[model samples]
Target chain A: MISFQHVTKIYPRNTIAVDDVCFDVEEKEFVSVVGKSGAGKTTLLKLLLAEEKPTQGEIFFQGKSINEIKPGNLPEFRREIGAVFQDYKLLPSKTTHENVAYALEVIGASDQEIARDVPKVLEIVGLTEKANNFPEELSGGEKQRAAIARALIHRPEVILADEPTGNLDPYHSLGIIRLLLKIQEMGTTLILATHNREIINSLGKRVVTLEDGRVIRDERRGRFIL
Target chain B: MFTSLKRVIRSGWQGFFRDGGLSIATVFILLLTITLATSLFLFHGLSHLLISSVEEKADISLYFKEEALENDIFEFREELARISEVKEVKYISQEKALADFTEKHKDNPVLMASLAEVGRNPFLASLNIIASEPGQYQAITDFLETSDFTALIEKVDYYQRRSVIERIFSLTSTINRSFIFLSIILSLVAILVTFNTIRLAIYNSREEIKIQRLVGAGSWFIRGPFLVQGVLAGILAALICLLTFSLIIWSLSPRVETFFTDLDISQFFVTNLWQIILIQFVTGILLGVISSFLATRRYLKI
Candidate 1:
């Protein structure tokens, strides 16, 4: 479970990235954040990931203020959540399998476990055939799947995906959405942020819409209304 | 922890080898730094030898007046030996000088005839003074100039040797000082160049680093591979430098020996083989590791 209490993020030169945002999601819920460019969707995820601080408010994961977590314990805390990027930030030097295994390796996973879990997760993302290929050798859709595999290999409680399908074709985009649905159905909380109306409307799940740095609407089974 | 360490090392090797262009550039720069370091060490040895040789060739011989007594010359030798700057002073009597001259020119009949025409020992009894250091030679000369036996002396020979001795002293000191200064400047440049290159390589991997952090990798876990890359580059450079220097010294020693009597570079290399390697290895590895550690630090914030 994650909660944001009146979080406000203002960049330098008086640019409000996220303004007075308050939200909460219970365990195992799938929610989409709909917003235009510069509407603070990515900033929201970054704040939760502790990559950036909220300019003015607190973010809580479970019962603890995520902001108050010491830098030394940050990585330990981050292990409870997974994230995917629009660009599918895969390690260029690593093969697809290695990239996925890296997540487990960070947590001191045994070689046997990595060898076991990585392939299974890669299979779910439909990248089993391209496991040995490097990111450079994979296509756009395949690369995103590899990123998804990396995110899924450890099975963290919450998966924060920031425009995961932004780079994919319509066919591949739908495939990624369906993959997220599968992940959500398996009892993992999913927070997806995207600008695509089709994907948001198709989700028919809880939606939080943002306009000019503030959440304008929130509804159960919400439609894309930005 | 053991499994994690193994994974870290494996990924590090993979990262190093997979970035062909950056790895090559990093290795080349590291090689250059190690080579400069090794050369500085060798030059220090050579300078020590040359300076000592120059100090050895320097001495002042005092030619006593032809009429001065043997006892007087012997007493003067005693006084010269008492000076702290003087290592030793030998009294070469006129008889010994004549005998040495004849023995040295025995192969030349003309020189023997000229010496025989004199019908007696024609050489002067002189005191040969050796100093412990080139700088000390000036003090020795000064002592001789103010000596009470100056009236009994024909020429102190201090003025005669002063120009050459001072030149050698200045030249050797210049070499030592310049080599040290050059080493300092060049080492700084080498370190900076290597650091910046590794920084660039890290910058290229910034995205992957973020992804790693997002996937719950600790700072050390993400840092391990880059540090490993640096170690590999360092080790390879040191080995290459060792081989290169060995080959160069072995081949160039014979030629270098022609100019510097009794100084064999290859022989010196062989004598201090382990020492040289240790210096090279420590320098190369430390530079590589420290640079990587620092360069990767900026990106490990997550």
Candidate 2:
């Protein structure tokens, strides 16, 4: 459902974040972008999210050019793709429930739907008891789970998660990976970027490996190999 | 759309209250600006009152000889009144002048005895001329000196009082110009200070704004709450300023009256109540809303 064709991103002062990399993911496919730190995995997801324009090349989602999307249409375009971050970028001012509801809120969902779906998603992520807690009050795992719930609440066509469990413990990490697997099973495209080798090997799904801003490997059911 | 707007307002209200210290600081800065604006308005009025009172004391009086007929003096008064520059011309008869003098000095025995010794209504019949402006007195004096009735005139007091009239004129204009200049500078400074304070406050939330954008929230959706907060703060500041101003004007009115009995400041305040309210509220709300709009625009670029 998403395509990155010869995408390259360069920052100021001659920093090549992602260089001439290309990849594509099928609908409902759970693609893990495996790389060490500074491997351009996050940059690749950011380009897909249109958070940053590619220094060179074009990204397409559902056969539409992401680079051509105008500023006024960006919000509508973004609502179709749910995004989760390593830091669990929940609105600190909002409780867990409000944070999840925010995703639906942006789409102009009915109040009944928000009141209905927010709790359902919060329950799916096992955060029902902590629905009213702010991000500061949540544990790392809970925070990540809350982020996942927000990502899932909108039921977008794809979920792009960047280092979602980077700060979680191994036990919490496994639980997050399991939750992600369950989400993928429920027919949502997933692109997870992480440097964690164990989680990659355990998932044994489609893996696009990056090294020095270049895609070194792309394999169906690939192993975590440097 | 209505639901979204309601949500935006709710979110803003929550943000304002949740950010206790920041909200208070923002309101405090806005209050200072509104207060300055209202004070400037009142000061403009007060200065006008002061200048006009001084102008009242600076008229020129023309003394007529005893031989000048009442018809000639009345006709002369009519001619002076027709001049555009002359604000007023009152013909004070010799007898009335003497009566006024006696009435004024009735409590002083020395002035009473001196007046009685002179005994035959020594005061001259005179025309008191008030020019619309201090500088116009010179022209009116010139008219009197060149008039056909100059033979009947004893003296025109303009030359004697020219320096004081010119001084009053210059002083009023200077006061007016200086006040306008000071008002502009003070207003600019207040606007800059208030803008920066709000910008810095929004800077603290720059990260939150980015995250909201990345999460697919629209620009207005994210900005709406901040604008709402701005409106709330502005309204509160204006209300507080209005109350404070009312109390202050009330307490100071008695003192002001003691010095300038002709000026009833409290009555003036009551008369201009709606105008002052409009100025304060408009200023307060515009400052808050515009500052928030600009500050958020910088961060909403994502």
Candidate 3:
């Protein structure tokens, strides 16, 4: 359902963020992107989200080039895919429930649907008790779960998580991994980028490993390999 | 569409109330702008009143010759009054002029003694002419100097008082022009300061705007709340400014009237209450809305 064709991203001062990367994922498949710090993992997601224009090559989602999408249509296109960042990126002013409901709210979802779906998703993320708390009041694990709930609130076709567990403790990291697994099992395509060897090796899923700015290995049922 | 609008408004209201510090800062800046605007308006009116009162003191008196007949002078008065530039023309008889001179000099022993020695009411009968504008005095003087009654009139005093009249003319126009220039400059400064304050406030929320964009919020959907907040802040500031002005004018009216007896600023305010409300609301809302719209635009591109 998604393809990256020889995409090369160059930042200022001759920094190569992503070099000639080519990849594809079938519908409902979960793919893990493994890389060290500054391996261009976040840039890949940003390019796909149309937050940054690729310096070279094209990114396609279901056949249409992402770069060619009109500026006005970017929001509509983005609603089809959810994203979670390492920073949680929750609206600081909104409560946990409002943050989750914001996804549905943007799409002009009916009040009844938001009232129903937001709570149900919060419950799934096991954050029902802290629905009214702001992000600052939540623990690291709770904030990640809140981010997950927001990503899953509208049932997006794909979820691009960039180091979602980077700030969590080992116990919380494992919990986030299990949450991603549950989300994938429900048929949403998941693209998870992380550097944690334990989490990557434990998944035993398809992994695309990056070194510097190039993908060095891709294998089904891959383990974390340096 | 209506539902979406309602949601945006509700979200904005919530955002405005929840972000107390930012909201207060925005409102304070907006209040300053509205207050400046209202002050300029009042100053414009007061300045006009003051200039007009000063100009009223400037009029040309035509002193009739000693042998000039009362009938001829009265006829000349009628003719001068017909000129559109002339605001008023009053004929003062010789007896009345003498009486006025004595009354004015009653407290001055030297002036009173000089007037008594001249004994037979030596003051000349004259026509005091007032013009609608100081500049129009020249036209009226030209008319009188070229009139048929030049034979009956002895020395229209316009030539002797020409310098003083011209000074008053230049002084009033200069004051008027300076006031307008100052108002324009102050207004520009107020707008710039208010815009920057709002821009800073929006800069703090730039990240949130980007997040909203990434989460699929349409441009207006994200901007709508800020606009609503702007409207709310504008309304609050306007109401507060109105109350402030009302209190200020009420307290200062008596003191101001003491200096300018003809102008009752409190009365002017009461008469123009609706207009003042309209001006305040328009100034407050436009500044708030436009500033927010521009400030939020830089972040919405993401």
Ranking, DockQ, top scorer first: 2, 3, 1
Worst 10 residues of 2 chain B by lDDT: B133-142
| Tens-digit lDDT string for candidate 1 (B74-119) | 8888888898888889888888998899889999999999988988
Model 1 alpha-carbon drift over 4 Å, by segment: B145-148
Query: How large is the i-RMS for each model, in angstroms?
Result: 1.1, 0.7, 0.6
lDDT of 1: 0.88
For model 3, the stretches where C-alpha displacement exceeds 4 angstroms are B82-84, B94-124, B146-148, B154-162
Q: Which candidate leads the pack in TM-score?
A: 2
- Candidate 3 chain A has its poorest 10 consecutive residues by lDDT at A208-217
Candidate 1: true contacts recovered, fraction: 0.89
Docking class of 1: medium
Model 2 docking tier (incorrect/acceptable/medium/high):
high
Error in Å for residue A212 of model 3: 1.8
Candidate 3 residue pairs in clash (backbone atoms < 3 Å): none
**Cα lDDT of model 3 by residue, B132-192, tens digit:** 8778988997897789999877777889988987887788788889988998999999999
User: Interface RMSD (Å) of model 2?
Assistant: 0.7
CA lDDT of each candidate? 0.88, 0.92, 0.92
The residue-by-residue lDDT of candidate 2 on B1-302, one tens digit each, is 99899999999999999988999999999999999999999989878987888888888989999888999999888888999999988889988998898889899999999988986789899999888876787788888878888899898787787887788889889989999999999999999999999999899899999989988899999999999999999999999999999999999999999988888888889989999999989998899999999999988888
